[model samples]
Target: MVNKSRMNRVAAAMAVAALVSVALPGASAQAAATTPRIDLRVLVVDDGGSSVEAITAELRDTGVPYTRVQLGGSGRPVIDAAFLSDVVDGRPRAKYQGVVLPNENPFGEGSAEMAALVAYEAAYGIRQVDAYTWAHPGVGLEYTDSGGYSGQLDGTQAAVTAAGKAGPFGYLGGQVAFEDNSALVPESYGFMGRPRAGYTSYVDAPVGSGRASLVGEYTHDGRSELVVTFGYNQYQQQFRLLARGIVDWLTQGVHLGQSRSWFAVHVDDVFAPDARWNKELDCTPGDYACAGGEGKESTIRMSAADAQYAAQWQQAKDFKLDMLFNGGAGEEWKAENGGTDALTAQLVADRAKYRWLNHTYTHPFLGCIQDTTTVPWTCVKDASGAVTWMSRAEISAQIRDNVNWATSKGISVDRTELVTGEHSGLKTLPQQGQDNPNLAGALADNGVRWVGSDNSREPAQRPVGAAQTVPRHPMNVYYNTGTNAEMADEYNWLYTSRAQGGSGICEDNPATSTCLPAPLDTDTGYLEHIVPAEARTALRHVLANDPRPHYVHQSNLAEDRTLYPVLDRVLDTYRTLYAPNTPIVNQSMKEIGTELGRRAAWDKALAAGRVTAYRIGTAVTVKAPSGVLAPITAPNGTKKQLLLGTADFGTAYAGNRSAWTGPEPLQSSVTLRLPG
Candidate 1:
């Protein structure tokens, strides 16, 4: 018999998933029609109110260009009748696409400024997004002052109404943070009765061919096509979404200036002591040492490696390279630098030169199997040393200890991400998605934003715990031998090739049966072994500007000799081959991962096909989802300079054919386009 119920359940789950992925829907006719625009900008009318700074800050961060008109500023026009008349008449000087009322009525209620705004809304159907509560009635909304509701709710959860989910407010349609202590309620608003005509429980109905979006019940007579939220202290993410959405709705589709790609290099094990694993060299078949049964030989000297790194730090300091520094090597570095105080001072001085990422103290294989049994990585109780995962507490301690250690040493470490010891926990091993659950929880609790993973797992940026997991290219270039026991021999064969000076192997080695002719230094090994591996790995993601974090260990700075060349060459090669013309942006793993996550959100919004874009001559009109900043990829395949709103709204031409213009607030629509 067919299990119809089971099939139905599966179908429902799929539908829910689909809905969550692409939440925005088409706008209703009753709501204001999408306003097309050449540039995206809003007029921020501030009377030096409390919310002005917060609103403007978000505006700046989210790339919403705005022209500030401080009502209380000296020499500014008072909220008088003349100003109202000019504003309502759509004076040539008032070239704005939209208006943002941050808090309270900039002008007192019933003032000419408030009346002017009302008239302006009537004359032009420009969108207005209000952050404060009291200004609702001034904009022609039927708001009962206080409406018998007033006070403070923080971190309140808000659910989007069914109507809201189907309307232009669908971008903010999910359950989000809501704070509304004082809200202007409509006289017709009732929570328990049969809903009123213009009431969606959250938003007031269309009054003047425009709708009012609200987090709480707010009055809207519809005189102005306004979106008002009587919320205070909203989550930054939610606030950003709301701000972008409002701009998109007002401008039709937002013209995100341009796109940018970022790349970074990671140097791990900077201060870590040379492990016993790195000293072995094997003679492969055809080498004279193969017959002597001397396959595994310890030949690397740690002191020489340390000296090279010490010298290289000067070059690193000079470059001011925004590189990721694995902090686990702090102790070793302290000892090498003479004392902990010196080490701390050195790191503190170099704070601006690099971003510190966690590499747990006494680094252990976070998830790698020690033996046949799947024991946790923190299995201190297990004498056999066969462990797979670390307990949640152990994982937490591992991360917290490293961060605390960094802090103690005056080294600021971003707790957001930790390059796991050997990239162990992030390995694509026994099965996909089979990660250490305890580690995930610990990371979430630590408020980490990103963690390192393997590029072979198709790493872009995926959510792991509460953080974005960004994996680097699998093929790595390091000072030490290959990771595993078997690879120790393979590492020797490659590291001591003719191109790498062909040294460090004895005659009659079991694997090669031959000895290397000369000793290969770290530089030679980098050229012969590491470069090719890195080149192959770079090819996979460099072109796409994917996060290809070229990782290296401490010893790679040198070999048996001092003053070696490895990391510099690696960086030079990456810059030359992967990003010749494109400027490389060396960001920390956390920054890169956070950007990836943001980009994903934008991509999702763009992919929804909800954006309506129209370009007329040099003018373009765009209607896009909120909380998204889409980059304008030129049709001619030009380098897209990011157009995130920095100052007042203006298009950044940057030699492109289009002559960009500043976005004007308080207007319904304008035309702008990329040059043909």
Candidate 2:
């Protein structure tokens, strides 16, 4: 009496229902049961090209963890399913959160390696960055020969698309101008092309009668690729300006490390007069090279009016200048001029408006006593043929006296911060190649935690007794120049060829200097040439996440207020390029020193393989050696998980939330929950 046909129909119906459960979105219960673990690391496939190297440099500089696979290296690991991913505790795990390829495909078409990478990316929902690629349909763009352009991109002005402004590159303002460092040399090259289907342009440049993509995202086969057309090196301004966007996009705005534009200016020799540059002699009059110029020496110092202008400038710009004051030199100037020193009085009255640091008492050389009889001075030595160094007591008095002077004037100064006269006492290469033996003790005596060093000389921070050295960059604006003409004259002397009516130092140092075809006219050079060049250099440093303060003499703030032009350019250009979300991080010397120290420790931990971070579903976990702060950048709304509950994570920066963090109390690792 059994209905076999009815039973068969019921079985078929059951099978159909099961298939529908797997096919419909949000109904695949088994597939939704577990989310794959995505390791917070990037995979970089290097073709040994500058484009790949540039992105790798950005990764390294930003402290993002990445594994590099050299295509040409014999020992390089193979790209395969096993290498790219694995099953961990019965759940799928992606080995990398993102991938950076030299181009759309370094591996030939139909190659198994390329297939493996594509499959892995698609399965993990990970993004890829084609660091540099030609415009072609393979990358979702039409060939440049078709309604596009192909050539040098130097001096080209590119704009971010609406998609870019709403996504990873939101930090950047619309325009991105390619660098034209040398008119004779093509600094940048690229192909711009019309986007094909599945392609969305992030950045584009004018081509023909329409705009074509320079950078764009291509989606196909369930994966995305950020395609870049231009060729650039790590040091190029164009690359730097776009580097952040590339990284953010590749990682989908979630990864380790954080970046910020940093800019700080230190005005040295405050309250003191700086020896003027003698254009006629092409040397500073008081300097040893100028033989009979001592009698004709003149000094440039800020008057009360200049001091007032400086305060007003700071207020207008909303930027603080670090004033490295020399009390004894101000007193000497006062005596030389009149009993009433208006500059000192004005600076004291508005002291709270600026940051004050010790620049020694009289700005005397604190290294070995210089034997200035020679053109390039040599260190004075005693009978034993050993260098006769400035004593520790003398160095201590210089530091102590300046701090006391600041205190007496009710000008707040950090006793722990000092910038030695000329960054001396550390080393003066070729003459005093070693630090004065007594300098370290003097720093300790004054409780100095940070002392300034010249970045041009010793760019890396190092220990000095119980303190550390905070290197400061010497700006191109000459310390001896107050007026624009003087600055231009000195710049021309240093940069022009001898045949061009100037010293040929640039020719002698071909590796470091670029000689001008002709001398810059003193009248128009400072405004038209020098300001932009100096501003560009300084902006490069800021974009590179450099926290080192740029140093210029107080003389640059006097007379013409020449420093303002360079500073203005830097500020204005930066504002024009970056959005308000990515403001310049201006920190005190102590704060910068601390940040550098933390980064060093974190980098060491990462290098030692002591740091482990991975994202599982909406949860991120990080473990590092105790006391080492791990830098983490995650999408906004991420929360740090505490023992009992969770707290909002990191401060917002550059469209994401990031911070240098360690684990909470009673925890050995950091855990964060990403927003749904």
Candidate 3:
């Protein structure tokens, strides 16, 4: 009762690389034999002709056929949907699989092209990638006619950088420095991980739903030659792997839901205005009780004592510490020489638990304003009681500012990830993606290369994972998006079954409770809480594949000095690869985003009905039925198992006959084995 089709596809993918490695001498012929020879078409946007020729010369040597189309070159239409019309209309068979936009324009022309490309991607649903640039895409350029602000810099100097945004990524991947546009070409999102200067930070919000994320500022790394953000360049190869993994995800290279893994834990705050969520969230209501919490029965003062507890996180070796949510602006980010260095210490102590990441300064629910009615450990939202999100600039401030706070002061994530205040509101930044722009465009703009999250999808959902991430993507996708990504209290339909009027999660939430970031043990099965070991469990699944999944903590990349225990182990996963595939030497997210552009083309071709059959060696092929065209039912293991309330992801495990299940089909060489 199991299908091996997906397994076969994975095997084939491995074969493609195996072929090259084998031929490289001392490589495995079997690996090379399984690799499929693929001819790819490439597009070079805004390349000014010279770079296009350079790309052609370089890629052609790899045995992949290609075609280069420059949007910013002569005879090419501008970004007003002129050229894209032909491609999506299914007219002149667009041969390019991906587009690479690389340049250095202080006039901000690069940002315009990047924005246009993003728009085209959205209109056509075609993926676009911005290569390593001085700045993140759409930023450093002039504000758009619509007043949306596309340019990121203020002419000569970059007005913004991604130095602080590294917090979130740090929690999942290792730490890395972001590339600043000043040292590099200044293109947004093109060159993440470039060496950049760093600063110390100290911004903290109370634990609430209406705070902002702590971001970083970008500086330059003179040694590596590229402008860099903190912890970004520190782990360059991590991004190369990240790019590879993203490609795997886009090409269906890695089917999610195919494997069964553990839930990824998320440590964050609750929305309650009690002491726990007060100091940083509702301390300044200006009410008579402002000085005191809602009575002693429900008061949580972010006391200095918490720092002692947070320090223990370093030894929690149960799992990979795959992720760490900044949990709404607790009393930490704002920690200064205030009364209790204890709260300050605890704030930094949390990073010791796992890799630090960009959680946005103040951890804004992004829907509301902050309230500083109380002093020390008491902050609240505005009287309007309405929530608000930070503007693109504000969000950037949080990220950049925090990075400076953590790095300069000596406290931050190990790596960096791109996420949002609450997984639901992951903005494309400056409000672009909602208008149909490709999400990748923003990451490309900032040069963020590594995307890290480890979560499981609800039962019955198909598996969706990034292949290049190796040990990272052995299981599911949307690691931090929903309950599978992190636990949620909302109990949305995704967790319920349609027949039961929902995804079955609402039925499970303690039968009535509406709290998220659930406790370790919940009385209700439906409200099952996520566990800390969720990340570890997922790693084990990857290890099951080969006893040695490429495991890397989120922090190891940027600050190798801290991950002494795991550095050697992390490298061991690929130690056997021929030629010692040394890390891509600081591959930025922008570069990976560039590689993913081709993936968008493939998807567009399928969506536009232009591509029907993919002749995979004549025998292995993909073809939709006549007029009954639909994507092949590639069964990833998503639906193979039962839904156990996930941990950490802050998801509400609304139990239902539909969400829970039994064992799953094991197809990989590795299998999950729990130590009794």
The alpha-carbon RMSD values of the candidates against the true structure, listed in the order shown, are 24.0, 8.0, 27.3
Worst 10 residues of 1 by lDDT: 186-195
Kindly list the per-residue Cα lDDT of model 3 for residues 266-291, writing each as its tens digit. Answer: 33321111221222222323323444
Compared with the true structure, the alpha-carbon lDDT of candidate 2 equals 0.88
- Candidate 1: stretches off by over 4 Å: 1-261, 274-349, 372-388, 431-433, 479-541, 560-582, 633-676
Which of 1 and 2 is the better model by lDDT? 2
List TM-score per model, in order.
Answer: 0.46, 0.94, 0.29
Q: What is the lDDT of residue 637 in candidate 2?
A: 97
Q: 1 or 2, which is superior by TM-score?
A: 2
Candidate 2 local lDDT, 204-265, one digit each (tens): 98887899999999998678999999999998877888899899898887789888899889
lDDT of each: 0.46, 0.88, 0.29
If both were scored by TM-score, which would come out higher, candidate 2 or candidate 3?
A: 2
Model 3: worst 10 consecutive residues (lDDT sum) = 649-658
Question: Clashing pairs in model 2?
Answer: none
Residue 378's C-alpha lDDT in candidate 1?
26
Q: Stretches of candidate 2 above 4 Å error?
A: 1-33
